[model samples]
Target: MSVFVTVVLFLVLAVAVNADIEVDCGHTEVKVRWSDPRSQMEPSLLKLGTCSPNSFYDGKAVFNVNLEDCSFRRMVTGGQVIFLNDLTHIYDPAFSQPVVCAFERHSDWSPPLYTPKFNTYGYSNLVFQMGLMNADFTGPALSSAYPLGSLIPIMAAVYQSSHQPLLLHMEECFAAMTPQPQPDSPVYPIITNKGCLVDSKSTNSRFQTRERTSEMHLLLQAFKFPLGEDVYIHCKLMAWDPEGLDSSKKACHFVKGHGWELLDDPARSDLCRCCDSHCMARRKRGLASGQGVMQKTVLGPLTIIDGSTP
Candidate 1:
């Protein structure tokens, strides 16, 4: 009977001590220790700190921990990560705020971190087919036609690469135009102000990524410009990392794309003119038109911040 009781107690103790454990690589508020075979044998070991010398090059850090473990796979597949045993807490105050985690795939080169990238293909029409005009007109006459009170849709889509998800918090966005007589000319006359016609309008507000990318669209019906003049269109966007907004580093990303296509009649220059305000509106209404996704550009590359780790 004593032996039976001892066996029961041992089983209970084993069950209590050896159980599957989860460590959220994305976010962890609790203390954790490494459960790998080596770390398990030496619970006190901390492995080498990720801050050790030569840890990062070209914005990517080589973490000493093996990412092939099931826990890592779980983290990539699912936001919440579960490890085999108690493990040392993984935390990088700079990167752990809201817990943004992403892994490298065999596909394209993954940026050091997950970031927003613009969809240039969707913007083709907005940049190329914005206006219709003849190429031969040269004098003071306007080469393009326009109807009053026309509205143009300016739009873009953004997505995070691979399967990693991201939540976007928009900060600011605007559309501007520069009118020039010739595409090669260095000087340009301003025809529109910031934000195009909706200077006070807000954007998508906020959005999260899924199997696909998120998008933003704007109706530009608020501009007063000379009819028949050719112009260049440019859009600039900025989004903030909600958790890192106050950081002095690159806490936000800026994306930009331009729409400028020279007509076949205009000597094939690189300038696209806007249709008369009312003309574009009637065209869309007539069609009842339905429509409707990159090299990842990093803000760090342009900013003074050195993303490389020492």
Candidate 2:
């Protein structure tokens, strides 16, 4: 009987895991229904009150909110856009406030920028980090050399991986590793938008750092020959600006020329296991890799009065 009970419990757990969750945001007139992409489930109740002046709404997969003045702001997986209206609300003070919000899936990565909120008057925090992945970080030093013809995926933690969370998009990206060890800089090949686009409002929403690690995965496999040298990885992160304004001028700084040792050993050897089969599979599929793998985990309707909390 105990064994049978255990089997029943396992089956129940499996079914629950496969079950889909839906979100329905409504008040009296407007209604928006959204279901989880992973499963096909029915809609459930999810009420969204007045969001704070500047905060992100994670209650629904895709949603649109009607402002106090009847104007609306829509948040969808495709992207986010704002529609301006002339007549602002006089009775409902919410409309006049500098309220800007985005609805995105939750993540473990730190916030993208360290600013007040996504839609604040002045919010700018753009930075990224890179590091090597070894089975044992405390064990003997590991080699960065990867086998020739194989792909090297260097994990990158952009804005969302920092303590500061700001709203920004991944305008551009590039990675380079030194083939031959030396002092003078070598011309490293440039790549763009290869992996995930680190953006707060994009479908690939950058999440809090404590929840996720390495928001971007960069693949390096441009070397034509297996040269014997120290492999150094350098990555650059740029901010995405939709309004066609200067990103740097707006404080959306770009990271460039920063280098990190990918593989420390002088030569490639058996001691080095610097390859990712899953990453290789992703490359083979060609684009659309990790589409929904790394998303923000929804806890509940989070009403953050202070958007500038570490």
lDDT of each: 0.24, 0.27
Candidate 2 C-alpha error for residue 7, in Å? 58
**For each candidate, what TM-score against the reference?**
0.23, 0.25
Best by lDDT: 2
lDDT of 2 by residue, 198-273 (tens): 2211121121222233243333342433253333333333323223222120111112232111121213222212
Output the lDDT of residue 47, model 1. Answer: 20
Q: Which candidate gets the maximum TM-score versus the true structure? A: 2
Question: Residue 92 lDDT in model 1?
Answer: 27
lDDT of 1 by residue, 1-310 (tens): 3522111100101122223222233221212222334222322222222112124333222223432211221222332222222223234223121112233232332112212221231122221111111222111112222233443333333543332222222222322222212454442221222112223222211111222223333333323443333223433332222222221111111112322222111232211223112112111111012211111111100011112322
In angstroms, the error of model 1 at 167 is 4.7
| Model 2 segments more than 4 A misplaced | 1-127, 134-142, 159-185, 192-214, 239-310
The stretch of ten residues in a row with the least summed lDDT in candidate 2 is 6-15
